[model samples]
Target: MSGGVDSAVAAARAVDAGHEVVGVHLALSRMPGTLRTGSRGCCTIEDSTDAQRAANIIGIPYYVWDFSERFKLDVVDDFIAEYSAGRTPNPCMRCNEKIKFAALLEKAIDLGFDAVCTGHYATIVTDDQGNRELHRASAWAKDQSYVLGVLTAEQLAHSMFPLGETPSKALVRAEAAERGFSVASKPDSHDICFIPDGDTKGWLGERVGIADGAIIDREGNTVGAHEGAHAYTVGQRRGLNLGVPAPDGRPRFVLEVRPKTNEVVVGPKEALAIAEIAGSRYTWAGLPQQHPEESFDCEVQIRAHADPVPAVARIQPTENGDEFVVTPEIALNGVAPGQTAVIYVGTRVLGQFTIDRTVSAVPVGV
Candidate 1:
């Protein structure tokens, strides 16, 4: 629940809908506002207190599952490793995929619950073929379909997102208040659950050892020195010591970050455009696939908050698993590995792939 207002009210609405609910606050090894976890603002004593109180008000049993060991390995370590490898990783998506949907769902099933639920701002709809699909919330501005596009077909079948249909946040709060829930006035967490202040590079450096690397220009000229090659990402514009001059007074962008060579390459903004991305760990959340040997043309969102880019998706064999390659209509701005590339059937999310490799192509217009 994270002691957030949306989750608390979501539990209330579940009960109102005549579904039995259990409140679970994932006690991850990393959360914000607690030095023990090196967290900036979550999973502190305050959050658990709020969760317990909300459960008490909702008349449901609340439990804190000690999944810290699993969380550290699955979410936290994966998060650090991705950055160390010169990629941006969304821990929230990791939390949703590995923790809430997978781990917690398993626990709920073991505990004899018919399904699992969360306060995610997205909806689930069954298609004409009876396949479960993820949909955007009525609250467009607050919709979180992007982060939640990684759910599997089995997971979506028994998952509940009560607030997704609740369009107005104001009305959700009002309904909570009318139910006499104390958390109706609580504020939503704006920062990541673990790294508070959003200093991703700093957090990464603290957890994993840093290595020195060079910042070079497009023509292989050493323009500056960076603390670590992994510290920079595509579309990044700051903290470079490049001595190169821009002919038209245009800004340089991150052209490449070769973690294998510890090289941070910078160049004109035009170099940031990418025509293709390779996805790893592909998963389908709609109809159960007949075989893992599948590929199709679908719109792919290379990362959360990135608008959908029409692309041709193809499945290829990877050393570890299947990889989905997406060739978008236009070159993408920043195609970072370790981020998610969610596939969509227009508005409905059919499946997703974890970014594994990025292919930089010059923007056509540039």
Candidate 2:
């Protein structure tokens, strides 16, 4: 439980179902000071206390598991490394993949638990062939199946999402209030958990140090100087501070971040259009053999809230392994490397992969 209404109500429902459930809150930060002030923090003392209180109200044991070390190594370090390599990463996906399902689930199973339940707004269902699949939550706006796309079939087998069928956030809060949980009105958490202040660039700058670089236009002319190339992401439009205006009287956007040369490439917004996205580290919630096809059509969600786009997904065999490629019917904007590309067949989540590269139709500037 994340000390929120959703989890509290989820716990209540679990207990009502007559299953032995224990609340486990993960302590992800190494130095969690006082509880954060705004709605940007998670895994803090306040959250844990709220979770414990809810657990007591539900008549179940609760424990705060410290996974700070593993979290830092897996999620934090990976975030830094990806940015340093001129790629953008979704750390939440990493946490779900490495820490929550892999580490925490394994430990829970060892401790004799049949499954680990969470407050995530997603669902796990069995197909007619007895195959487990992940699906979007009934609450479409609050669906978080995109983040949990990294879960393999094995992990999906041992996961539960009680709030998946909850129609709305208000209903969950009502249930929490009905259960007499104090966090019924608690604000939902937002932004990155570790970066409670929601200043990702500032947080990254302090950790990766500064590498002063040039902000260059499409023609390779330096338009401005940047403190670091790693601070910017592809398709970014603001804070470029480019002293030079476009010759064609057009606004500039970040088309690329060249870390090796310590340069940021600026261009017209149209330059961000990408026709193909190639991803590595692919995972499927269903058996690969079940499909028995090299290519399939599916809807691809580039980010958590982004609209799903129609695409043809190809599983290409390479010497290293297999790479998943998505060819959207229309160009996508702001697709960045290291970001997760979640695949869906209707409301069911097929799987996801980490974007490694992209193919753009438009040249640097036109």
Candidate 3:
């Protein structure tokens, strides 16, 4: 349980189903705060206590597993490395892929647990052949399948989501209240868990010290100077403090962050439209495509809450290896390397790839 209403209610429902359930709260931080900053962060000491209280009410065993070291190495360090490399990464995806499902699930099975159940707003469906597939939850507004897109077929087989069929988060809250869960009205955590204050730029500036860098426009003209290229992300418009404004008096957005040269590239908003994205690192959620070299129709989701876009996906051979590539019918804006592209067929999560390259719809000097 994450000490939130969703998880508490999920635990209660699991118990009501007559299954032996144990609530495990992951201690992801070495130095967690005593109290949450009004839901700005999670995995704090307060959250653990709240989880224990919920477990007590549900009449189940509760344990706080210290995954801080692994979390730092896998999630936190990866975040830093990606940022330092001028790539935008989804830390939640990494946490779900490395820590929660892989690490936690591995330990759970060793301890004789059948599956690791959580309150994630996603579902697992079993096909005719008994092959498990990951799908979006009934609550579309609260769907979290995008973050769990990294789960492989094996992981999905030993995973459970108690709230997957729930119609709405309001219903979950009501159930929690009915069950006398103290966290029934608890606020949901937002922003990065480790950086509770939500100052991502400041947090990164501390670790990857600020370095003077040049901000250039598409024409290779130096438009501004930045304290650090790592502090900026693609599509960011504010805080540029550009020395030169666009010739047409339009606002410029960050188009790329070149860490090798310590440079940030800014350009017209229209230039952010991305036509193609590809990456070598990918995994299927359930079954692999029968014809990997053939392009298949699918919907591609770049962000958690972003609407899925019509696209064609295929695995193509490259010098590096086989790369998963997607070409959206409509150009996707502000796509960046290190972001995950979750491919979906209808409601089922087919697979996901960590984007390493993006081809702009608008060419340079266009």
Candidate 4:
């Protein structure tokens, strides 16, 4: 339940539906301390107590499953590795893919459970042919289907989201209050669970030690020096420490972070504009029969909260599986490698893949 209002209400609704629901709260960290206040220090001792209280109120079995080792190996290690390789990764998506759906769902089914229910704001629909499809939530502002886009068809079959139709977070909170949940007004967790302070760059620096390297302009002239390339991401501008200014007196942005040479390449903001992106490691919730063709039209979402843009996508079969390329109608900025790119048709989620590279729109020697 994550000790949140949404999950408590989801448990209540599941019980009200007369389905036997067992409340399972994942213990993702080995050393979960009560370091911060509500929602900030999630999965901590206090939060688990709140979840147990809600489960007691709903009159269901509650258990805290320790998945700390698997979570660290799959999600935390992957996050560090991706950052070290000069790519920005969405760890939340990785958690959903590896821990929540794969590990937790597998264990749940083995324990005779039909489905694993979550408080996510997405819907699962069954068509006339009995095929399941994943759709966006009715709550646009609180929709989290983008993170769940990594789910495969098999995973979607045994998943449930009770708050999919809930119109707003306010309504969820109200429902929690109505049901007398202790976490009715608990604030949402905004920062990453492992890094509760939200200093990703600093946290990465501690693990991957600083590698002194030159920060150069687009033309390869050294402008400044940085501790490490892993500390910066594409399109970041605030902390470059570059004393040099562009010839045109315009602000510079991080065009690329090259981990191979430990170089930070800075250029004008326009240099970050990219129109084409190629991705690998694809997973589909459900594929249309006519798809798997050379090319088709779809909406591509580069980030979680970003709007999906109209694009022409090309699909290709690889020895490992399938790789796809997306060409947006309009160029986008800050599209980074190792970040997830989800494909959608109208409101239904088609699939997603990790962005491996991008084709910049800005020409060389411009």
Candidate 5:
């Protein structure tokens, strides 16, 4: 429940609907004074107690489920590894796929609960053909379909999002007030859930250590020595302290990160554009029987908070299955690897893709 207003209200609505509901708070190991306020701080013990209080207030039983070991392996380790490879990984999406849907959902069913519910702002709908499709919530600004694009049909079959139709965040808080839940006015946590301090670079430095690296210009001249190559990412505009000034007196941006040679390449603003993205590790929730390549025209979101834009995509042949290559209608800026690429057809979602590689294929002077 994360001790948040949204989940508390979700529980109340479920119970009022006459569905048998029990609150399960996931206990991720972390000491007190370390975790911050908000729904994402589920690792802290205080949030666990708050969850229990919410359950008691709702007159339902609650329990803490320890999944710390799995979280470190599935979410934290992979987060460090991906950054080390010069890619930015979305830990929340990984946590949902590995911990929430696969782990927690199965655990709920095993414990005899018919379904697991959350406060996610998205909806699941069955069309005339009875195929499940993920759609955006009425509260478009608060919609979280991008993070949840990884869910499979089986998981959605036994999952519920109670705030899907609650068009306003204010309404949710009001409901919480009426119910007497405590965290109605808590500020939302914007950082990654596990790393509340927002220190991804420090976390990576501690885990993988630093790789001696140099900041090089596009022409391959060593201009500066970066603390580590993994500390930077493609299209980064700040933090490059190059000793030399640009020849044209224009601000330079991070054009690429070469993990193989431990190099941070910086160049002019024009160089930070990309055209093609090939994403691996695809998990589609409501995809049709036809190949992803056949599902050609769609909208793709390269990251959360990114607007879904029109694109022409194809499933490129890979050894395991296929990597998706999407050509956006316009060149995207700062496209990074290790981020999820979710495709959508308006409100109906196509699926999700883990970006393996991206390239700028637009011909110069076009």
Candidate 6:
């Protein structure tokens, strides 16, 4: 239940619907904190206790499953590796894909459970032919389908979201209060769960280690120096610490992180516009496209809260493998490799791909 208002209310609603529901809280950390630092992190010992209390109130079974080892290998390690490769990754996306749906759902089915229900703000729709599709929740402001974009057809078939049809998070909170859930007013967790302090740079610095590197402009001129290339991300402007400023007196933003050469590239904000992105790692949510080679119209979303953009997507053959490519009508800002791009047709999630390459809208020396 995540020890949050949303999950507590979701469990209550599931019980009210006359289904046998059991609340399972995943212990994702081997060494979890005794208490949460406000709402900065989750999956701690405090969260597990709150979940058990809520389960008691709801009159259901509660269990804390230890998934720490798997979480570290799949999500945490992947995050460090992506950063080391100079790509920004969405850890929530990986957690949803590998740990929650795949690992948890697999164990659930083996234990005779029909589906793994959660409080995620997303919907699952079944057609007449029994094909299940993933869609956005009714409340766009709290929609979380972007993070769940990695679910395949099989996973969607055995998934349930109790709060999908709810109009607002305020309503969920009210329902939880009415049900006497202690977590009704609990703050929602934000940022990476494992990194409780919300200092991603400092957290990564310890694991990835720091190396002095040169920060250069687009023209290959050194402008500043950075402690580590892994500490910076595309489009970051505040911590450049550049010794040299732009000749035009304009601020420069991080345009790229070259891990191999240990160089951070800075440039004008306009150069951050990305026109194209593609990757070989991809999976369809429900049904595969009938014509894989043909370009199809769709909307692409890179971040959880980012607005969808009009785009054209198609599969292209590459020497390494087949790549899912998207070209947005309007350029995407600060897109980076290792970030996932979820494609949507109307409200339905078509599929998603790990972006491995990006083509800038503005070329160098332009």
Q: Model 6: which residue pairs collide?
A: none
Give the per-residue lDDT of model 5 (tens digit) for 143-199.
898889999888878878889999899999999988988877866655776665767
Residue range 139-237, candidate 1, lDDT tens digits: 777778888887888888889899998878888889878877777777666556666557777877887768877888767778778877767887789
**Taking the tens digit of each residue's C-alpha lDDT, what string does model 4 give over 2-94?**
888888998899888888999988898877741234566567777889999999999999999999999899998999999999999898899
What TM-scores do the predictions have? 0.89, 0.96, 0.98, 0.96, 0.94, 0.98
Ranking 1 against 5 by lDDT, winner: 5
| Better-scoring candidate (lDDT), 2 or 6 | 6
Which regions in candidate 6 have their CA more than 4 angstroms from the true location?
A: 34-36
lDDT of each: 0.77, 0.87, 0.92, 0.87, 0.81, 0.92
- Residue pairs that clash (backbone atoms under 3 angstroms), model 4: none
In model 4, the runs with Cα more than 4 Å from the true position are 34-37, 317-321
Stretches of candidate 2 off by over 4 Å are 34-38, 289-293
Question: In model 2, how large is the Cα lDDT of residue 196?
Answer: 62
Error of 4 at 306 (Å): 0.7
Alpha carbon deviation, residue 57, candidate 2 (Å): 0.7
Instruction: State the lDDT of candidate 3 residue by residue for 208-250, as single tens digits.
Output: 9999989999888999999999999999999996999889999
TM-score of model number 2: 0.96
- Model 5 quality (TM-score): 0.94
Give per-candidate clash totals.
Answer: 8, 0, 0, 0, 0, 0
lDDT of 6: 0.92
Pick by TM-score: 4 or 6, better one: 6
What is the C-alpha lDDT profile of model 6 across 1-366, one tens digit per residue?
A: 888888898889889998899999999877776224556667788888889999999999999999988999999999999999999999999999999999999999999999988999999899999999999999999999999999999999999899999999999998888888888888899878877667889989999999999999999999999999999999999988799989999999999999999999999999999999999999999998779689999999999989999999999999998999999999999998889999999999999999999999999987
Give the deviation of candidate 3 from the true structure as CA RMSD.
Answer: 1.1
For lDDT, candidate 2 versus 5, the one ahead is 2
